[model samples]
Target: MKPYPFSAIVGHDQLRLALLLCAVRPEIGGALIRGEKGTAKSTAVRGLAALLSEATGSDAGLVEMPLGATEDRVIGSLDLQRVLRDGEHAFSPGLLARAHGGVLYVDEVNLLHDHLVDVLLDAAAMGRVHIERDGISHSHEARFVLIGTMNPEEGELRPQLLDRFGLTVDVHASRDVDVRVQVIRQRMAYEADPEGFAERYADADAELARRIAAARALVDDVVLPDNELRRIAALCAAFDVDGMRADLVVARTAVAHAAWRGADTVGEEDIRVAAELALPHRRRRDPFDDPGIDRDQLDEALARAGADPDPDPDPDPPGGGASTEAEHDAPQQNPAQKGKPQAPTTRPSAPPSATFRTRALRVPGVG
Candidate 1:
């Protein structure tokens, strides 16, 4: 099956960059792409998987974590069939095993079970799974890039697990009429001829893959200066990020971004970009406490310390992904404005991947 080409996908430059940074440096953890439904969040991820596979000839595919999955299927469990047939204790690998050395993508992740979220957090952080159940000791290397997509309307991820993701990029639908038309035309074109449409973008995709490969080679040499490192610490301090993990991941992501841009050493611009990706999810979302890191302070520090502002400070979607699914799925037809002839926009529902898992566990505080 042909995937929507990564290069062909429109808008969300920061999202694309975050995906690349994760690919180049898996140590940076995975990216959590939050957006409303039909914003091409899943499409971008699928396209990324295809592009990466073609670019690196990686046999491992993106492992989809379907909502119907159980604790046994996701983590691992005793192989009952093997134990019964062979009369010997055996362990059966789960989705995590299959996702080894690949991408583990979870759609509508915010709606998933808390326990499931907990399991993922442990494995992602450790880069391995150590399962000890029923006197069956098991441990193997299980490292993969974890990509999760969610529509905020369903719900928000717990602040604890939310911080686990290395980078977070919001995805929003294009408001520009021209861009929207281009998106639709391209979608129709691809649907008509997936192969031919992919063929058209093949060169661009290949070039991007090559660029990623080159970045991987140079990531080791991308180093940060002492003063710049201090700035990163200062920024984190201003934000009052929970732990050193945030401080450390920012540095790691910045270095990878520098390498992605083919720069030998890290730069201020790289740090600025890294902050945007890493800080949002990490900073304490306090409704009351407004910290003193104002734009002027940030600008003054940048001026005195010579930090370059983002070349494209604002992305195309201007507003990032609409977190709530209601934005796209729920169209409120205002009844007050009668007979204005506003055509209701309807999007085809995606085939049910699993029996609506979100509704399974309700009663918020209950297990």
Candidate 2:
């Protein structure tokens, strides 16, 4: 089915950005979208899948985990059909296997059974799945982007499971009349004729995918300067986030944010944005303390860390083509170095090696 176009989604810019960031670099782990029923959480996921499909030229299958799904069905199970037909007990892969290299989205995740949540958390953390059931043992790589949606009114997730997710984005229905109207009109337009609506935004979706692809290519080169690393650690310390995961994730996320903006290195601006997304959920929980950051304090700390305040130009728009690497011996796509090349430096010719060595043997006292 054609999904509602991502660009057509009315507002919730942060929600949309978090989802896209997770997609661009799954290593940042998953994003937990918390909101009420009509906040377009699931719609955003489907749109992301569609966006990935257009970007990578594959379906980018989105495997939905049903609330009532059994444990065996979720992890893996014995192949009854294979056993009966061939007299052999084979291990049948489950949702985790199918979700490899795609997305595993669970709506109402807070309401899922404790066991099920544990299973997912284990797989997500390990980046692989191993199952032993009914005398069948099998293990294989299973890495997929994880997304979970929840309504706080329904329940709360375990702290353990909540921290498993790399990022969290709280969403609510749009209160602005114009935005609400646009959301409704877009929904109606999509429902009225899904194909046409999708087709209308095809170019924009493709552009978005290319932009993500370029950012993915460029992310590895977007280094964090020593000051940025210090800043990341300082931010984590300020929040009193648990473990080293937040520090490492914040560093990597700053790199990604810089890459997304087509910068060659992580900067203060990237740190601010990355900290907002990476540090919020990881903060020590206090009922009285706000879950978000203190913008003023963050700015002060960043300045004290000697962060550069220079603003960069907006990144170039993605071109209409696949932004993939070339094969061996072929020229690199060099997405990070997309726009320009620097002037090459040259060295002056040196004197003959034998002549230089003989002449350098004289001591200062003798001379």
Candidate 3:
């Protein structure tokens, strides 16, 4: 059956963006999709693979990791049957090898064996797999985008494992009646005529794929300003996250966001969007703790890092092209609004006043 077109997937803006970011910049690590069943999670993953295939003009297939797969089957093993027949042991590539240069998707990943999960995460982070079994040892590149879906009600991954994912998004069925109706109508239409339905969205998928390719090519050249670096670090620190992984993930995610926006430099909006995607899961102090950062808190953190949490939009460049930080920061000159004075913007480094003893301002407890 034809995979549902990614553009046709409805009402999953964050999920779509997270998957695209990982596709454009795999170094940002893979995304973990947490949501209920029947929320189009699996469909979205398959569609992303198809979209990537269209975008790169290659067979970037999607390899599903079965729930009951063994370590040998997942990583690789010796071809015992071939050895018996030929009297020579040979390496047999596994799912990891088969998924090279594409996407390795694990459904119900939380239910998979902990050790298997470790193996997958290890390969994802290191971009290589090692096999040391049946008196034969070998290593090969296993660089592939890792995407996993899980229902939080079934179980939760250990914090150590959870922290490995570069980005995550929570998805839920839409509550709006109109959206629900549209989803059902689309599903029925696709089921009735899969080929025709796919053809209708092919152009859109191709256009998005081209954009993704362009972003991937430009991501390396996209500048990460010093102020943006400070903002990323301060945001992670303010959330009181466990370690430095959050900081690094936020920085990489911000750069990817800049490239996605066709911007030469990372802006405050890019950093903010990066934080929203990368920081929520990392900030959970306990399994039961609600996962999210307060908007005011995020703004304060940005302010502390010398950024305008809510800066004005960049003016359109003459003759039409990507916008630069210089253009965004430069004062605007619109004759229509020239008579009115614009509000002053400030971006100050970590001021001493911003740093004060919390205890000093605490009121005496009446309890």
Candidate 4:
């Protein structure tokens, strides 16, 4: 299928940003796309593949691995004929090998078998795959930028596998009438004349490619300041996130944003946007909750960071500390306190009951 040019995608700023981040830092892990059908998820990935192909100077385009593919197709298998006839091992490179240094797009990823998912996850996590089947063994560098698309209506991915993704984005159908009209118009034009439509966006695509290359060069130089790092930490904590992955994603994504904008240092706005995108899925409680990243907490963090240098050490409370006092005085009991009274009395009851039952059972005629 022909992918619509990356620049021609109408309005998926978040998805675009996440994909860009993955391209900048493949170490940040892959991206997961969740949306309904016909939302252009696959189209966006293919467009990204085209953009990345240009930037990376690789002729091997993005490798598309369909769902429910066999293990032999994904990680390669031995050549049975060669082994039987000549006693020589021959290996065929699989999708992962072909995807080296490029993008690996998996459509309908949620429908893939658990074992195949594990294989992909292992390759992604280790940046290589090892084969030891059929008395043949070898390892190949199989690194690639993994991009997966799934429709939530079909099913949900296991949390373990979901957490492996560094970024998750949701794409919704277009709502604006004018934007929809534009989308339809563009599609019709492309269908009428694919090459001409592609040519029209050629310059735009080239400019984007230049920006991606420049951003890649600048990614290592982008600095995340102490204040921004602390803000990211506080945001992760406020969201009750589980691991250190959230913090790393926020920091890296913020730096990528800075690089993409041609800045050397990350700013508060960069961290804010990154936190919104990176921390929502990391939250352990209520992944779909509104204000999932604790907007109030983030706002307070930003205010503290941007406040005047010599301001008052203590600011006046809105209600003169009454709310703070009430919160302090609220009655509560620790688990230790609640269980102290019941610990000692239940230890002596079992032996006496046993003795009485034993004596009564010796006289069996009484009942």
The candidate scoring highest on lDDT is 3
The TM-score measured for candidate 1 stands at 0.78
How well is each residue in 171-277 modelled by candidate 4, as lDDT tens digits? 88889999899889988888888888888998998888888889989999999887677777776776678888888878888898898899999998888878777
Deviation in angstroms for 114 in model 1? 1.6
TM-score, candidate 4, is 0.78
Error of 4 at 238 (Å): 1.0
Better of 2 and 4 by TM-score: 2
Which digits, one per residue and each the tens of the lDDT, describe model 2 over residues 73-155?
99999999999999998988899998887889999999899889889878876789988779988998777778999998898
Candidate 3 stretches with Cα past 4 Å from truth are: 286-288, 307-367
User: Which residue runs does candidate 1 get wrong by more than 4 Å?
Assistant: 285-367
Give each model a TM-score: 0.78, 0.79, 0.81, 0.78
Q: Mind giving the per-residue lDDT tens digits that candidate 3 earns over 1-367?
A: 8999999998999999999988888778799999999999999999999877766666758999999999989998889899999999899999999888788999999999999999998898889998887799899998788999999999899888899999989999999999999999999999999999999998989888998889988999999987677777777888888899999999888899899889889999999988989998899566466666678878888888775354567667788865797678788798897788888888888756655555545568853
Which ten contiguous residues of candidate 4 have the minimum total lDDT? Answer: 352-361
| Residue pairs with backbone atoms closer than 3 Å in model 3 (clashes) | none
